[model samples]
Target: MQVSSWRKAAITASFLTLAASTANAAAGPLDPTQGGAGGRIIRVTTLAKDGPGSLKEAVEAKGPRVVVFEVGGNIDLGRDVLTIAEPYLTIAGQTAPSPGITIIRGGIDLKGHDVILSHIRVMTGADGKPHFSDWEADAFSSVAAHHVLVEHCSFLWALDENMSASGPRFTGKTLAEWRANTSHDVVFRDNLAAEGLAFSSHPKGEHSKGSLIHDNATNITFYRNVFAHNVERSPLVKGGAQVLMVNNLIYDPGHRAVHYNLMNLEWTGHPYVTGEITAVGNVMRGGNSTDADLPFLTIGGDGDLKYYGQDNRAVDRFGKALPMFGRYGETKARILQQKAPLRSVTGIPVLPSGEVETSVLQTAGARPWDRAPDDIRVLFFVAEGRGEIIDDEHQVGNGYPKAAETRASFNPAAWNLDTMTPRSGRYPGDQTGPQEKLSPRDAAMRQGGV
Candidate 1:
């Protein structure tokens, strides 16, 4: 087959190229994304930060392609961020060997839409930066993106917000234009965002945030995920955002958990647009370093947040009940007791809050069946009701794992290329049976060949 270019139209948002895809993408009007379904397979043969056979190259490749990892272990990014600006890209991180691919000292930044990021691990350390330096990075984020699905990935030790959906609020003029341009139709489901680095790298002191759904970012769903040990912003929605948060476990938020804040200064001349948040069947448990009397959802300045909730649970370390809603800013910033329009738009099923902790720990994060040490440590901490906000990543989990690097060839016959799932219902190093029921510590020890 001849190679083809991934074209982008000047006017149309998603219509880019015409390639002979297995299942044609960009064939019709914008629909829900099927990441790189029709594209050719691009094997990542090296764990180098960038180069012909590296993960960076696969993401930055011109045409639609499914990026599969043959190599596993850490790829030290050396404090750099790999921005995937192309559309129709599928990063098949589950294809890697045991321990899976872990990106260290950096992050994956998304700008283009029509992307699926799954089964990946990104651990962003402080990188030897001073406490109040200007440096910042998200383990995974949509800087300005849409039509994306991020699932079953692990994001931790971020210098700033661990994950975010953000973009230029006003690319054109008027409300419709703002909504069209900003990040929308983005979903973070069955993933993990934990241990955002406090008091490190970011210029502002104490910047351990989870997800920042920026102004005007609409149709955002955070479902069945885990947010732990982050000081704040276990997803803070800004002005004009539409969001659905369901069945997520939030632990050890220092002064905040799930919050809605529309800072006035950030809006400046723009008209204040109301944001709506539907938080249902979510669990928030206070842990060490959690602020006294922390609310599950805190409403802040400038804009009123239309809110609705059902069966949400918030408790202290001792299992004492906590308030579901609180206000920190203006008396005008109201939490309207009404169901958000987004609640009806999304179809994410909600589990009871009581089951969230167990469900998240079992399935959240990259390669959950073969967790790396840091993931095990974080999940273990959450399970034991122990953990704290940290200024640096090395404060936990013996830092990064010291596993010897491993690699293998791409055996096309073993995987379903369209879905990037193994044909045998098992990944490269998946160990089922008794190991499936092992404790996190035992799993870690076993993973280390001890």
Candidate 2:
């Protein structure tokens, strides 16, 4: 089901140019109406998976609600993925005390619009299950959902894609309608997606995908994130998918790193709408477990891909350079060159590729001031050239931390309801900088700061 390659066309109209000083400028390009603005604050008071005062309860509550954490600890979902269908929601994990909320043995299925999630950790670990035995899930997912901005979160130990944006590719009658129906206006920034479990519960035998921007999903942005220890997808863009990938640090890729593929079979009777990826100032460094000679971006399938790549760095284990692009599957499928990205998305904070590694280590992931052990290991491994793509979470350090659940009251007046940012610019229950209480592991990592 392969379609012949097409010639490059003129660049489309711009999306939106974002300014940080604007009344509503989120981390990503989407401006105004960040999430759950002026909505009821739903407090999570329990570490239980679903009962009253639980995260699932807060997520499932009807109408627009802002979810804040009263308890800080791990919420075990018993290997089940919690589905989120409510709209206009904001999950403010940063409101928790000390070590913030972490969801273990489960994942988040975000199917809501106008949502924002920040400072949350999700570890969909292999729960001691046999190799390739049972079901698998991603640490976070947004399918057919729009107006999302997921910031400063950590997604780890997933048997599938760590974080993904996807939906029915052929949902509407026309291509424009279809693209609108799929996931759009979504942003993933300042996050860590690492160690997506390879060869574990995924029936696919080897599935450690960083993320997948599925076909027809448009207006997606991945900014200043760390994609570490994942085999591939880091992430893959499919047909008609338009993405702005900027200032991201990709460490220890198994086979691929930013790729675009439009499966002809998936497009069957539908037209082969080309995918576009604007990659700017990203760094890709191979690690111990990386596949040899893996390129930074690869093209496959049958549909032509429109690409605009600038200032991206790709290097092998010893700092030797690697090819920036490759072709596979349908080799004849051409890559259409673009001079610039669409104008729709504007406020691109593209750092110099050389500085991406440092920036990500310092700021990426949930609660960088208090990184989870696994996240600490992942960041250090990226820095020190250690760590590998593993099949199980237990192979590394303690699979999940067991912190005593602590309660705290969230004062909504102290936060900007739109962005969930504290009015005082300082988070609650935090000492000054890296000088605060540091665990031995954290102390060692933060010689200056992690």
**lDDT values of the candidates?**
0.80, 0.80
TM-scores of the candidates in the order shown: 0.88, 0.89
Task: Give the residue spans of candidate 2 off by over 4 A.
Answer: 1-28, 31-33, 343-345, 429-450
Candidate that scores best on TM-score? 2
Tens digits of lDDT, candidate 1, 134-168: 67988888976989988878899898789899888
Off by over 4 Å in 1: 1-31, 339-341, 345-347, 433-450
Candidate 2 per-residue lDDT, tens place, 1-450, comes to 211011000001111121121122344334424677677889999999988999899989987888888789899999899998888877888788868999998998888898888889999988887776776888999989998888889999888889999888888799888988889888887789999889887877888999999899988888878999999999999988989888888999998888889887787888788788888889999998888888999999989888888898899989999999898884557888888765333545455787667656766788765667677778877888989888888788767778777787888787677666566655655443332334888788878665
